[model samples]
Target: MLFNIFISDLDIGIKCTLMKFADDTKLSEAVDTTEGRATLQEDLDSLEEWANKNLLKFNKTSSSSVERDLEVLVDNKLHVSEQCTAVARKANRMLGCIKDTTSRAKVITPLYSVLVRPHLESCV
Candidate 1:
C-alpha cells in the first residue's frame, strides 16, 4: 500500500498502457507503425524522467524476448506450446535435482508435490 501510494502518479503523463503490479511496471503499446513506435519511445523517456525525479531505479536484467503478463508467457500468436514446453523443462530440471538429492522411493511423492507440481500446473 505504501509503495502504491508512492508511485501512484507514475501514469500521470504516460500515453501508453501502464501495468503496475507490486514493484514491476510495464509500458505496452502496439508497435505496428512508425508513429506507434515513436509514441512508445516517448512514453519510455517520460518514465525514465519520472524515475529519476522519484529517486528510483529499474531492473536492467529483467528483459525477455517472450513477454510475460500476469505471470503467463505470451506471444503475438497466443500459442500455448511455448508455455507448455517451458513448464515441462522446468519440472524436469526439478525432478532431476530431486533424483540426485534423495532416493526416489523415499521422497518422490512429497518432493514432487511440493516443488514440481506447480510448474506442471502452470500451463493451461
Candidate 2:
C-alpha cells in the first residue's frame, strides 16, 4: 500500500490529483491497510529492492511526455495557432484604424464643401 502511495505520488505529481486518497481517512487507510505501520515500512523496503533491479529500464523512457517524439509534426500546428492569433489582433487594429480614418475624412468633406460653396457663389 505504501509502495502504491509512492508510485501514485511519483507518477501523478500532485497528491491532490489522487482520487483514491480524496480524504484524510482514505489517505490513512492507504498508507497502512495491513497489520501495522511496520508492515507498510517493510513493503517500502521490498519496493526499493525491486526498483534497484529494474529502475534503469524505467528511466530509459520518458516519465513526462510522448509529444517530444512527434515534435516536428506538432511544431507547425503550434506555429499556426500563434500566427493566427497575431494576425487576428492585427486585423482588428487595422479595421479600427480604417474606420477612424473614414470618420475623419467624412468630417473634413463637409468643411471642404463649405469653403468651396462660398468660392463658387462669388464666381457664379
Candidate 3:
C-alpha cells in the first residue's frame, strides 16, 4: 500500500502541498516574484532530501518542460501581440469538446458527456 505524505511548517510559513490519485501526483506553487520562486526551489530541495531519506526514488526525467521567452497572457487580457498563431487559430479538442479558435463555438458529442464531462467537472 502507498502511504500518504504531508509536510507543513506554520512557523516558517512553508507548506508543500501535494495531491495524489492512484499513481498520479501533482505539486503546484505560485511563483510570481523572485522571493516566491526562491521559496519554491527551497521547498523542492527539501522534498528531494526527504524522499532520499525515505528511500523513495523519483523520476527526474518525467518533469514537464516549458518553452522559454513565450508571451503569456495575464488575467485573460492580451499584453503583447493581438495576432494569434496558426496553432492557436485551429480548433482544440479537449475533454470531448471541440473548442474553436475564438472559443465562440463548442461542439459536444454524446461520448464527451459520458467520458470527458465528469473528468473536466472534477478538475480544481
TM-score of each: 0.60, 0.22, 0.42
In model 1, the clashing pairs are none
Q: Judged by lDDT against the true structure, how good is candidate 2?
A: 0.41
lDDT of 1 at 51: 86
| Pairs of residues at least 3 apart in sequence or in different chains that clash in candidate 3 | none
Clashes of each: 0, 0, 0
Residues 31-120, model 2: lDDT tens digits = 444455655455444544545754622243434322222222123233334334444555556555556666677765665455434433
Which structure among the candidates has the greatest TM-score? 1
lDDT, ranked from best to worst: 1, 3, 2
What is each predicted model's overall lDDT from 0 to 1? 0.86, 0.41, 0.47
lDDT of 1 by residue, 21-101 (tens): 886787999999999999999999999899899999877776555776677787757666778888999999999999999
- Candidate topping lDDT: 1
Native-to-model Cα distance after best TM-score fit, residue 112 in candidate 3, in Å: 12
Worst 10 residues of 1 by lDDT: 62-71
Which residue segments of model 3 deviate by more than 4 Å? 5-16, 63-124
Query: Roughly what TM-score does model 3 have, to 2 decimal places?
Result: 0.42
